[model samples]
Every structure is written in C-alpha cells, then in structure tokens.
Target: MSAPAPIPDRHGRAGRNRPGSRVWLFAVPGMTLFAAFWLLPMLRLVGVGASGPSGAMAYLAVVTNRHYLWSLVSTLLLSAAVTVVTLAISSLVGLFLQRNRFPGKSLLLAMLTFPLAFPGVVVGFMVIMLAGRQGLIGALTDKLFGESLVFAYSLAGLFLGYLYFSIPRVILTVIAAAEKLDPALEEAARSLGANPLRVFFDIVVPALTPALISSGAICFATSIGAFGTAFTLATNIDVLPMAIYNEFTSYANFAMAASLSIVLGIITWIALALARSLSGNSVPATA
Candidate 1:
C-alpha cells in the first residue's frame, strides 16, 4: 500500500517528525530554562547555606535560633490565617456576585477587585493610610475616646494588606467555578429538607473544593513570600521574609538568607503540592 499523506499542520507544513522522534527536542528549551533559573539557583542557595562557618548547621538555624524559629512560625501562621480569611470572604462575595444581579453590580465588583492593580507596596501603603497613626481610624478613635487605633505597622496591617490583594484573585476563581455549579443539585437538596447551611456545605462546597484548594494554596504562598508588604509593615512582626532580608542586607549573613529562602520555597511548594493532590489537578504556584 502507498504511504498515507502526511498531516498538514496549521502552517501548512507537513508533519515530518514521527512520535518519540524529535518530540523530546520541544522540552529542551524548557528544561534548559528550568535548570538555569530554578535548579542552578536552588543548588547554589543550598551550597551557600552550607558554606558558612556553621556549615550545615546554618540550615538548622531556623529551629536552633530563637529569632529565626519565631520568624518562621510567625510567617507560617500569618500565611495560614490569610488563606483561611481570604477564602471565607471570597466564598461569600463570589457566590453573591454570581448568584444575584443587583444595581451597580459591575461597579461593586470593580471596587472589590480594584486592589489587584495595587502591588504589595501600594497595598501596604494603603493600609498605613487607613490604619496608621495619623489615619482616619486613628483620628476617629482619638476624637471619640482619646485613643488612636494605630495598627498599620503591626501583623494586623500585614494581614489586611495580604487579604486585600488575595481576595480579588480568589473571588474571581470562586465565581468562575461557581458558574459551573448545577443549580438543580441545590434545588434537589433544598427539596429534600436540607437547610441553608447544610445545602451549602453538602452541595456547594464539594463542587467548589478544587478551586478553593488551588486559590487558598496560592494565597498562602503569596502571603508567605510577600516581601514588599512585609518590608513596609514589618516594624512589629518577624515574618520570615523580613528576617531573610535582614540577614542578607543588614547583617550580610548569606548563609542564613539562603537557608531561609530555601525553607520558604519548600514550604510554599508543599502547600501547592497538597492543593494539587487534593484537587486532583496540577495547581499553579502563582497567586
């Protein structure tokens, strides 16, 4: 039999390469980029972390050193808190926006997502303006009871900054996922005597679990590594990002900085991995 004609590609070029032939070449650039950017830097970071006077013990500083340990713990706790709060708030707002149509809906969504335009630094600045010593909240509190409500340089401020940026991304995801939800399922649940909370938990949550997991993981990772916001408002908090910055810049402790960076990246990876595993999909590592 004569050979079949080759399949024409979009460019009208005949498909000349056979499967398992030059397919591997397509991955060469990706592999090279990954190695040059990620793999090599990671290896260098590990080496630098071990090359200090403390040797491999530098990596252990996060646990053996009180300051480092507390910094890591605080970062993890703050990131977790941000993830939970962001998800909860996003869930409510996303459902409301998707399920109901109201006047100024577009305007409301635009306002809700307006924070996405602000970088971490801008968000931090906004928090300071809203809650700083001379902020409106402080002025009001001082006027009312002679006590200014100043928390813009504290962990609370950091949390608010993170939440401001995180909610836009997460709420969008929730709205997109919720768009695919089967209303009949909810109606059936309601018809079967399920209460509001029960129907929500049993019917809605499962449908949105994948999106929630992925977005929560991204939010957690962003909070964990959000250096700009932390740098701006880290006056009273010891988040790991600020600690790493101090080690690298203030003390020139390359080993400690490298170790902290490695630890932070690993923790972020773990969160993404867990989310992927739970969602049965490859969750992205970006916010």
Candidate 2:
C-alpha cells in the first residue's frame, strides 16, 4: 500500500515548505497593547508587593484579616442583591416591550437605557441627591413618615447605584434574547389552558434563563469591582473595593491591595465561569 500523504498546514502548504510569514499580525498589536496596558502593569505591581517585607506581610495579613473577610462578604451580598433586583426589573421590562403593545414603549426603553451613558460617579452623585437626607425623596419621606428614608452612605445606596448601571445592561441583553424567542411557544402554552402566570413561569422564564444568568453575572462583576459609586455614595460603608482602595492609597500598602485585587479577580472569574457554564448547559444544542 502507498504511504499516506502528509497533512497540509494552515495555509495548505506542506510542513517543511510552510511560509515564513508572520501569522500573528492580527494578534500582535492586541497582545502588545494588552501587555503594555494590563499584563505588564499587573506584573510590576505584583513585583512591587513581593519585593518588600511589609508589602508581602501586609498582603498575607489582609487576606487573613476578619475585617477584610467581612468586607468581601458585604460586597458579595450587596452585589447579589443588586443583580437580583436588576434582573427582575429588566426581565419584566423586556417582556413588556417584546410581548405587549404599550404607548411610548420605545421612549420607555430609551429612558431605561439612558443610565448606561452616565458615568458611575455622576450616577452616584445623582442618586445621593435624590436619596440623601436633604434630597427630594428623602426630605419628602422624612416629612411624611417622620423618619428619614435616606439610603445614601449605606449598603442600600451602593445597591441602588449598582442597579442604575446593571438594569440597562440586563434590559439590553434580555431584550435581545426575548426577540429571538418564538412567540408560538407561548401561544401554544396559552392554547393548552395555561394561565399567563403559568405560561410565563414554565415557558418564558425557562427560555430566558441563559440571558438572566449572563446579565446577573455582568452585574455582579461590575458591582464587586465598582469604585466610583462606592467611593461617592458609600463612604460610611466598607465594601471590598473601598477597602482595597484604602489599603492601597491611604495606608500605602500595595501588597495588601494586590492580594485583595487577586481575591476580587478570582471571585469575578468564578462567577463569570459559572454563568457561562450554566448558559451553555441551558441552551439546546442545534444540529
């Protein structure tokens, strides 16, 4: 029998005769930029931390510190709450826009997404003005209820700020998913005597799970890493990002900050990975 022919390389050339041309042209600039802006800076920061006894010990100390752990726990709790609220609100809004005909629907969606255009710091300031002790809603609530409903400088403030950013993201993602869903499935459920609630729970909700997961993951990651809003609004509260900042700038402890950053990065990665995994599993495989 004749020997099997050698497999062609990427350009359909034989192994030894492959072109010497650079195949990394597309990747070269991006990799270079990434290294320059991200990877190199990260390495330098880590090196700075590793080089000093105070830095390294501070990092270890912060990681094992109960205060740091509590801050992380608080941050996660706040992030989760915000994600849940944003997901629920955005999903409902998307369903309304996609399925029901309402007046000024486009206008409403545009308004909902307007927050995405605002900087987080600006959003935080606006929220504080609206919900602070002397602000509109807070003043009204205080006058009517004889108690301040001021949410500024608290976990609630942070959550509200996160929701402001996250809701728009959720709306955009879920609306796209909603648009792709076949309305016939919903109609069939209705024809089978399924109530609106039952159809929504059994059919619509299941279909939108992947989008919800994705939006939640995005919201969670952003909330955990958020600095602007947390700095502006939640000064009284100690969230993870704020703690990291304090460790880095106020205390001048780069090692502790690095350690905290690594922890935050790990958490974000895990949440995103879980979201992707869940989305992949939920999506039906096509031929």
Candidate 3:
C-alpha cells in the first residue's frame, strides 16, 4: 500500500504566519500573571489542606467542626439574602430605565454606577454613617418610630451594607441586558390582548432571566467573600471569610484557614457554574 499523503495545510502557512495571527502572544502575559497570582495560590491552598498522611483527616476535622459549619451556613444565608434583595431592586430599576425616558436619567445612571468606583472599605464606611445609630437616617427613624433601627454591628446591618454595594452591580448587569431587549415585543403582546401584567410575566420578565442569573451569581460571590464590609458593619457577625481571617491572622492556624479558603473557593465556583448553566438554557423573550 502507498504511504498516506501529508495533510494539506488549512488557511495556508502564510495566513498562520501573519503578524495578527500572533494574538495568542498577548494572552501569554495575562495567563502568566493569572497562573502566578491566582491559579498557583488556589492550588497551593487546596494542596496544603489535602496533602500529607494526616492532611485529609485534619481537613475533615475542620470541615466537620460545628463552629466552622455554622460560619459557613451564616455566610451562605447572608449571601443569599443579599443576592435576592439586590436582584429584586435592580430588576425593577433596570426595567424602569429601559421603558422610560426621565429627566436626569443620565445623571441617575452615573450615580447608580458610582459605587463601583469606590473601594469596598469606603462603601462600608458610608453604610455605617448612613445607617448606624448615630447616623442621620438611623436617628430620624428612631425619633419617628420610637425604636432605634441601628444597622451597625448586626446581621441586619451587614445585609443592608452589602445591599448598598451589591445593588449597583446588579443594576448595571440587568440594565445592559434590558437595553438589548426590543420594547416592541412587549407592545406587540399588549396589542394581542395581553394585559400589562400578563405581558410582563409572559414576556419582559423571562427576557431578563439571563441577566438576573448573572447578577445574582456576582452578588452572591461578592457577599460571600466580602471582608471589609463584614469587618466594618458587623465585627461580631462571624461568617466564613471572618472565620478564615481569624484562623489565619488571629489564631495563626494556616492549615485551617487554607481549608476554609478552599471551601469558599469551591462554593463560589459551583455558584458560577450554576449561573452559566442557567444562562445557557435561558431563551430571550424578545427573540
């Protein structure tokens, strides 16, 4: 039998050799940075927790510890609450912005996105000033309601503080999706005898699902890993991040902290995976 002929080059060697074809070169630097800073550290963390003859046993003990479990539960609950609240408020705001033209709409949009530019620490401080007992709103509410609605150093306070930072992120994500939507879709549904409420449920809301999932995942991840906000808003509230911080810094338990950090990383990764899966299956009502 004759030897098999060499495979023909696709796109020709010339095309492959073009200067722009070296785009992969640009990715090298980013990949190098990511591998060094993020990927390597994450691997080291997981490795340290799961390595050695006793490492698995040690990690199991940490994971099964009642205190650690409680901290994880509290963090998840708080993150979920923040995610839901952010989604609700952002969806409404995004829908309003998409459907209406208002005076100072541009200014409002700018202000809404302004929080993204601030450091998390600064945002936490702002929340404390606005909602703490001595703050204006807190004082005013106390005077009117005869009860102090102090938000600082409490779980409720932490939730509200997270909301202040998270809502803006959700709004931006949802609004981008909303802008891509065709208003005519809703109008056509109304013309077809669907009521406004039915049209919203049947058409508008479904179109926003992908955006909502994306935003919720982001908010969930941010809330779970938040350090500055938790530190400032509720030092007494022990969440997973706080637990990890204490284990590493206060108790000097590097192994335990690394184990907890790995757990948090895995949880965030699972959330992101779920979001991607949901987004992949979601169909835009506009189309």
Candidate 4:
C-alpha cells in the first residue's frame, strides 16, 4: 500500500508546537498574573511581617499578645458561627422556596435575596436600625419593659450583621443546588420507609454536601475578612480585621498589621483548604 499523505495542519502553525511549549504559552500569562498579584504581594507581606521590632518572630505576636490572640480567637469563632447559622437558615429557606409554591413566591425570594445588593456597611447599618439604641427593637423593649434593648455596637450586633449579609449569598447557592436534586431519590427513600428527617439526612444532605461545603467556606472567609461591617458595629469586639486596621492606622504599626494580616490570611486559607479537600472542589480564597 502507498504511504498515507501527510496530515493537514488543521490546528495551524502554532498547533505544531510541542505540547509542553503550548502549555507554557497558555500558562505564562496566568502565571505572570498570579505572581504579580498573588505571589509577590504575599511575599512582601511576609517580609513586612518579619520587619517588626521583634524581627522575624513578629508574626508570633499574633498568638503571644493577649489582645491579638483574643482577637484572632474571636474572629474565628464569629466566622464559624456565621457559617453555621447562614448554612442552617439558607438551607431551610432554599429548600422551602424550591419545593413549595405560594402567592408571590418570586417576590418573597427577591426580597430574601435583596441583601445581596447591599454592602457590608449597609448591612451593619440595617442591623443598627433594627437593634441599635434608638432602633425598633430598642423602642419596643423600652415601651414594654422600660429598658432599651440596644446591641448594635457589640459582638451580638456584629453577629447579626454578618448573618444578614451572609444569608443572601448562601441562600442563592443553596437554592441553585436544591433545584438540581433528584426528587426521585427522595421518593425512593420514602418508598424504602425513610421518614422525612431520614430522607433529608440520607438523600438531600448528601446531594447538597458539596454546595454546603463550598458556600460555608465562602461565608467563613467573608466573615473572617469583613472589615466594613465590623468597622460599623465593633465597638465592643476585637475581630482580627479591625485589629489589623487598628494596628496599621491607629497605632501605625505596619509590622504588626502585616503580621496580623498574614495570620488572618493563613486561617482563612486553612478553612478553604479543608473545605476543598473534603469536597473535592476548588474553593475561592476570598469571599
């Protein structure tokens, strides 16, 4: 048999390049961007962290210093609380909205998700308006018990604000995931004598685990790094972000600020990393 004709250069001259070279070509821009934006900044941050009065051990102050350590702990706890509460509320609302039909359902959903449009500061202000000293709750309590129920400048207010801001995004994620769940699986579970709770835990929860992991990670990261809401409502609390701000702005301690920032970033990274490892998917570094 005659030799087959040479294959046509369907992918063009560039396509004739080696696979490794092609990969480098495609990857160079992204790698360059990553280095410029992410890697360089992180390295500089590390350097700054080490440039403190204590030298390279400056980052240790995040744990060694009582105030800084407490701030870090409080931040982690708040972020975890926000993640759990947001997941719980979002899951319920998402499921109900997805499975049930009622009057003005669209309107209700739109209203529920309207918080997504508001910034963190706006959410804090809303919290203040609802629970601040002169807010509705305060007025009601004062009217009923002769005591104002003010909490808008404390950790409680920060919690409420974070929850409010986190719920909308999480609800959207849960709703999207809920819509894709197979009703047949739920039905099959019921057919097999599984009760509502059983079916939910066995079928629905498993199916939605990935979404929950991803969204919870995002919520945690957001809460960890959130500055605006904390700035607006953290009179009694010392969250890490606010601590970093105080260090950098109020105390003019660039080294402490950089160290705190690195510590904060490391904690956030660990949370996302764990979620990704468990969920087998990519998670965003920042919310």
Candidate 5:
C-alpha cells in the first residue's frame, strides 16, 4: 500500500509543515520591536541609573535621600490635589452637560473640551496668561484690592496649570461615562422619595464611580509627571518632573535623572494598574 499522503496547505503544497513549528517566526517582529523600542531602552535606562558615582544606590536615593524624597512627596501631594479638584469640578460640569439642554450647550461643551486639544506647554502658557504678573487676574486684583496678585510662577501656579489640563481630561472621561448611565435608576431612586441629593450621591455617584476612579488615576499620573507646565510656572517649586529636568539639564546628572525617571515611571505604572484593576478594565489615559 502507498504511504498515507501528507496534509496539504492552502496553497496545495504536497506536505504540511509542523503546525506550531514556525509560530515563533510570527513573534519575531513583535519581540524585536519590543526589545528595540521598549525592553532595550528600559534596560539601558537601568544601566544608566546605576552608572552614578554611588552606583546602584542612586536609585535608592529617590526615597532615602532627603532632597529627592521631599521632591517626590511634594509631587505626590500636588498630583493628589490636582486629581481631586479635577474630578470634583469635572463630575459636576460633566453631569450638568449630560443631563440638561440649553441654548449654547453645544458651544459650552465644545469650549470645555477644547483644552483637550492643547498640548501641555500650551496649557501652561494659558495658565500663565491667566495668572501671570500681567494676567487678567493680576489686573483685576490690582484694581480691586490695590495689589497685582501674582502666583503664576510658584506652587500655586503649578497647581493651576495642572488643573488646566487635568480638568478637560477628566471632564471628557466623565462625560463619556455619564452618557452611558441609565436614567431609570436615578428616577427610581427619586420615585421612592429620595431627594435630589440622595439620588445624586447614591445613584449617580455610584454609577460614575468607576469613571471617576480611572480618570482620577490618570489625572494624578499626568500631574506627577507633568513638566512643561511646572517649568513655566513652578520657578520656585519642585515636582518630580522638574527635578528630573534639573538633574538632567541643569546639573547634567544623567544617572540621577535616569533613576528619578524610573521612580516616576514606577509610580505612574502603579496608578495605571490600580485604575485598571479597580475599574475591571483597561482605561486609556489621555496625556
């Protein structure tokens, strides 16, 4: 008897290839790209971080050393504040925009989301124009209170810059999530004699909780890593981003900068991971 014929491929080749033998070929490009773009760069960064005078101990200085630790702490606090304020304001505005219909509503929403199109540097510049020495607030305050109020080049300015970008980001996320909510749940809560506040807190807030959490995490991460705005406004302050910039540029401490960068990346990754895990899905973070 003739030997059994081999299985034919789609092209009608006489014999079939071992099913999984060449699967590794499919992964080559992906692995190569990953290694070239992500893995190799990361490994190189690690090596650089360890290339300092103190060697691998420079990474530990991020938390153990006083100056670096203070910078990290300040950045954490600032980012937390920005995230909370952004979420609070965005939640209200997003809910109102989603629930109500009024003249110019579309225009108002367009204006609100317009900042999403602005880069970090542009947002920082806008903040400066609003809070700078010659800005609108300074002019208004000078006339009203006999002082040209200026905080745009300080921590306050940094906070405002963070909020400027953060608000639009969280607003977009909140609005998207809010639109998907069921009005029936809210109406039912009210039908049972729950007051508007109760309905809001119990029904609306709960429904929007996931969005809020994820968006807040994104905002926090952005604020922590933000540099352009901080550079424009935080002339007298220090955040992690600014610290890294100073280390890299001003002091030319590449190793220290790399270590700080790694630390910042770790914290940002943790925030993103928590957001993903708690929201039960991956939430894309807008810059």
Candidate 6:
C-alpha cells in the first residue's frame, strides 16, 4: 500500500505543520502583550514594594501604620457602601426602565446612563458643582438655613462622586440582566398570588443575583482604586488612593506607595476572583 498523503493547509502546502506551532502562533501576541503590560508591571511593582526600608514587610504598613490602616479601611468601607447603594438603586431603576414604556422612556434612559460617558474626574467635578461652596445645594441651604452647606471637599463628596459613576455602570449591567430574565417565571409567581414584593424578592432577585454579585464586585474594585474622584475631593477624606498619591508625590515615598498599591490591587483582585468563581463567569472590572 502507498503511504497516506499529507494533509494540505489553506495555502495548499504538501504537509501539515506541528499543531503546537499553530497554537503558539495564535497565542504569542496575547502572551507578549500580557507579559509586557501586565506581568512585567506587576513584578516591578512587587519588587518596588519589597525594596523599602522594611523590605518585604513594607506591605504590612497597610494595616500597621495608623494613617495607612485608616485609609485602607476607609477606602474598603466607602467602596462597599458605593457597591451596595449602586446595586440597590440600579436594580430598581433598571427593572423599572425595562418593564415600563413611556413617551420619554428613551430620553430618560439616555439621561440616566449618560454618566457612563463621563470619566471619574468629570464625575467628581459634577459632584463639586452640585455640592461645592457656591453650588446649588449650598445656595439653597444658605437661603433656607442661613448657612451654606458645603461637602464637596469631604467624604460625602467622594461618596457622591463614586455613586454617580457607579450608578450608570451598574444600571447598564442590571438592564442587560433584566432583559435576559424569563417573564414567564414572574407571571407564574404572580398567578400563584405572590405579592409584588414577594415575586420580586423570590423570582427577580434570584434571577439577577449573579449579575448583581458580578457588577457589585466590579463597582467595589473600581471605587477602591478610583484616583481622580478621590483626588478631586480628598480635602478631608483619606481613601487609600489618596493616601497612595500623597505617599508617592508629596512625600516621595515611592516604596510605601508601591506597597500600598500592591495591597489595593490584591484586595480588588480577590474580590473579582471571588465574584467570578461564584458566578462561574468573567466580570469586567473598571480600574
């Protein structure tokens, strides 16, 4: 019998190339990009973090030092608050927007989600314009209460800025999740005499839980590392990002800043990882 002929590739070559060679060819670009952009930076950051006077223990400053610890804790708490509030408000608004149709429905949705087009710095500026010393709220309070109420340079302002950006992101996710929900399940629950709240909690909430968890993780991660907003309104706030900024710039404490950054990245990564594992899917997190 004659030997079997070799298979031809798309170019009509006589013989097949190694399968692993094709795989590597397909993967090399991505691997190179990852190494260049992600792996290398991470390694450098780790090395920098460990190069401090405290050496490898520099990372412990996040918990050991008073200011660093407070900043880290405050950032986590603020991010958690933003995540919870964003999920709650977005869930309601997204479901309402999805279920109802009105004359200005499209316009309303555009307005609600318009913030997604704005960066964190812009969001922070908007927050300042709304709550700054000369802002509308301050003016109104000045007229009504004989004193201007300004919060644009404090934690309240940071919270508002975070909430502003977070809402649009979460609402988009919630709307997408809501659109995929099975209407029949809600109808079935209603037919059984389940109240609106009961149906929502039992049917709707469960259905959207995965999306919520995933989006909430993303929101937390984004808020944790949010620099622009914190920078814009950190007069009295002490979020980790602001702290890191101060360390790197004002104090020239590069090692401490690197350590803090590593800690922050680790926390955010763990949150994203847990969400992915729980949801059994990838969730895109904003930096």
The better candidate by lDDT, 2 or 4, is 4
Tens digits of lDDT, candidate 1, 1-287: 98877766779899964556668999999999999999999999999999999988998888989999999999999999999999999999999999999899999999999998887888888898999988889999999998999999999999988988999999999999999999999999999999999999999999999999999999999999998888888789789999999999999999989999999999999999999899989656897
- Return the candidate ranking by lDDT, descending: 1, 6, 4, 5, 2, 3
Q: Which stretches of candidate 4 lie over 4 Å from their true place?
A: 1-23, 282-287
In terms of TM-score, which candidate is strongest? 1
What residue pairs are clashing in model 1?
A: none
- Mind giving the per-residue lDDT tens digits that candidate 3 earns over 1-287? 98554443574433223445668999999999999999999888888777745676656765588999889999999999999989999999988886789899999999988888877678778877887768777888888998877767778778877888899888888878988888899889989999989988899789889889988998999999999888776556889888898888998777888888888988999998899789875455694
lDDT of 6 by residue, 220-241 (tens): 9999999998887777889999
Q: Which lDDT tens digits does candidate 4 get at residues 48-156? A: 9898888877788888989999999999898898899999999999999999999999999999989889888898899989999889999999999999999999988
Clashing pairs in 4: none
Candidate 3 residue pairs that clash: none
Per-residue lDDT tens digits of candidate 2, residues 146-255?
Answer: 88788888888778888888888998888899998888999999999999999999999999998899889999999999999888986588998999899888998777
Lowest-sum lDDT 10-residue window in model 6: 15-24
Q: How far is candidate 3 from the true structure (C-alpha RMSD, Å)?
A: 6.0
Instruction: List TM-score per model, in order.
Output: 0.91, 0.86, 0.85, 0.90, 0.87, 0.91
**Overall lDDT per candidate, in order of appearance:** 0.92, 0.85, 0.84, 0.90, 0.89, 0.90
lDDT of 5 at 164: 80
lDDT of 2 at 21: 51
Candidate 5 versus the native: TM-score?
Answer: 0.87
Give candidate 3 misplaced runs (Cα > 4 Å). 1-26, 51-54, 141-147, 281-287
Model 1 regions lying over 4 Å from their true place = 1-17, 282-287
Q: Where does model 5 exceed 4 Å of error? A: 1-31, 282-287
Clashes of 6: 0
Q: Could you give the C-alpha RMSD of every candidate to the true structure, in order shown?
A: 5.2, 4.8, 6.0, 4.8, 5.6, 4.9
Query: Cα lDDT for residue 114, model 5?
Result: 85
Steric clashes per prediction: 0, 0, 0, 0, 0, 0
